[model samples]
Target: MKQNLLGAIYLSLAASMWGGMYVISKYVLDFVPPLTLVWLRYIIAFVVLFAILKWLERKNENRAPIQKRDWFLLVWIGFIGYFASIALQFIGTKLSDAHTGSLITSATPAFIVFFARFLLKEKLTLRKICSVTLATIGVMTVIGWNINVGTYFWGSIILVGAAVTWALLSVYVKIASERFSSLTITTYAVLFALIFTTPFMLWELQSKDITYESSYVILGVLYLGIVSTAAAFFLWNKGLELMDAGIGSLFFFFQPLVGSFLGWLLLHEKLTFHFFIGGALILAGVLIVTLPTKSVENE
Candidate 1:
């Protein structure tokens, strides 16, 4: 129970960091193109995490070498997660409002739940079903009634693709947890992502003008790279290692909660009755997923 609580905290913190990232990214996006920013983020994260991982390996000489199968898994995860998923996320957010991005991507946990069942053989309980349903509705409500798919058609589709890829990444992360340390897995996965993103970054740079002189831009990039990408990803993987994937995913709902708050604070976005109502439902869903029933506890 205690471990579960700690895992929840870790995952929630990760989600919160990512939520805040949208605000920071929105500002940085003005200076950096989407793919370039993503490439830079992975590059920074790779360096930081790799240095730490190397240090740890040096300290612990008994650490086993990585297996070939794990390398394949890690590469696959990076390709789908960083190369495709995050890129899609950035594109979606670039095309849409931060609030809409957060709300639409809030459905990630629902996809994670289903993916966990298939990939990790996680149980599909009635409680989980109800929780996902309620949380999805909450996301819709928070996005408000003016959700015309035709308007932000491409953006919406991209966000949905992001959700799917991220879901797949989460499930695979759980699978990888069985073999490798989260630190090693995260570091190498990010390295692979950097490798994959380099060409795209180069292509993007050809057409986009970059301004690296601004201190604010540097700070924003650092925040996205170190805090959101590196630290949050480690925390998220740690949380998944400690808890069931489906249950742990409830913490992902925190993204919208924090995103909404940051949106209001940073963008001067207005909060409505729908926000509160939807937030309540989202919270309730999280509770239902996290707080096991009496029967489960007894078992």
Candidate 2:
């Protein structure tokens, strides 16, 4: 009840589920187009989560009124958090290497910790600072620190933008939940994402013929929309509302590790020394952030 191990374990598992999502998403591209896959994800999420929450209301433990100010923030969360980030991520992944996309996206936690301090009025600690530093270094290493790879440049930039947007959304959710239910926030976020992406959906339909042209297409859409978008994000915001942003974001570490493994096993990508060493640092950083220190327990 004090946001202890149970809470941490639950949130960590949720994050791990998300970490595994990239592999599923990367696998599903042959069955669905990126934009269409995004659309279906949010649309399905909107319906499923709304209905699930409604049914959950009977538990008499979950329900609330969200104030107008909170509503405004959540709307943006849905738009930016759900729609924009999701769209940009797939777009970036589409154009970039899986390794680059993953490394850049890991910045979500770093953003959360940064924004928590600067925008949400949270205190920073030395251990967290070091974790952030190490994670950043690890991510940069995976990015190759060499800009000459024209193939990965623009895509990496977009992925970085996606990471930033997601971090901002996490901060907004943390602040917004003070006056709103995390359930309401999650539900509304998906609904608003659906609304925001509708224009793109129309344009997509008008111009492109979205076919389940490849098995990759199908897997990408289903996994991203249903599991990653709906379950992962909903749980993420929930965990963030209940705990520190840094702790919540440490869950993101799984994404790159899972992605890298799957890429080598499935995508036939080479597993370089850089990938393993960088991944180890990122994973270690996540554990460092999530584990309770003496200061936390004594407090």
Candidate 3:
């Protein structure tokens, strides 16, 4: 019970941080191009994560070496989750509108549910199905029906690919958790992602110049690297380690809700009636999955 609560807290915090990440990324992207910014974020996050991992290793002094298979899994996580999904997301959002990107990628948790069932062999409970449906509806409500589907068909497909890749990342993280600590998994996975993103960053630099003159841009980069990448990734992995991937995935709904709230707060965006209604449904869906029931307890 305590672990479930902790898992929920971790997942919620991670999702909320990612929600704010959009706002920070919006500001930072003006100075840094998409691929370059992703590369920088990974570099900073990897350094921080590596330092902490080393400190923990020293404190423990008896950690086992990671196996070859584990290394492959870690690399897969980095390539698919950090590099590919993020790149696809940026490209898709560039091609489509933000509304289409948000609406489509919001299906990530649903994909996670499917992946969890297939990879982890978790049962597809009625509760999970209903929760995902409710939360998905809430997300559509929050994002609205402002999609330019005919114009952005290819972008939408890429965003779907992004969602699938992210879901695979989540499930793979859970699988890896059986062998390594979440910290170790996150650190090593991010290290590999930094490696994968290097060429893209260099390629992007050939065409674009980064503006480093503004303090706001510097701070935004730092925040994205530290808070959103390092801290949030660790939190998310740790959360998934503690709970069933499907149940933990419902907390992802918090991302859109918090993003909407932050947009209203920081950018002075208007809050519509749909935001509150959708936000409530999202919260309710999370609660339905997270809160213990008699049947779940028996299982």
State which candidate has the highest lDDT. Answer: 3
Tell me the tens digit of each residue's lDDT in model 1 across 1-299.
88888888999899999889989988998999888898889999999999999999989999888888778999998999878898898889777765567667877888999999988999888888888888778877777656545778889889999999998888898999888888987898899999999998899989898887789999999999999999999999989988888888878877777888899999998888988998899889878877856796432
Residue-level lDDT of model 3, residues 129-197, one tens digit each, is: 989999989998888978887899999999999999999999999999999999999999999999999
Q: Relative to the unseen true structure, what is the C-alpha lDDT of residue 150 in candidate 3, on a scale of 0 to 100? A: 85
Error of 2 at 40 (Å): 0.6
**Highest TM-score model number:** 3
Tens digit of lDDT per residue, candidate 2, span 1-299?
46745456656666666766656765564545567767888887777788888887878664565567767887888888888887888888778866677667867888888888898788787778877878777766655665433778888889988999989898888887787667778888888888888888888778666666666665566666667767877777778878877656666665566666666787787888887788778777766766666776432
lDDT-best of 1 and 3? 3
Clashes of 2: 16
Error of 3 at 188 (Å): 0.9
Off by over 4 Å in 3: 297-299
Ranking by TM-score: 3, 1, 2
Count of clashes in candidate 1: 0
Instruction: Candidate 1: list runs displaced more than 4 Å.
Output: 92-103, 151-155, 297-299
For each candidate in turn, the TM-score is 0.92, 0.83, 0.98
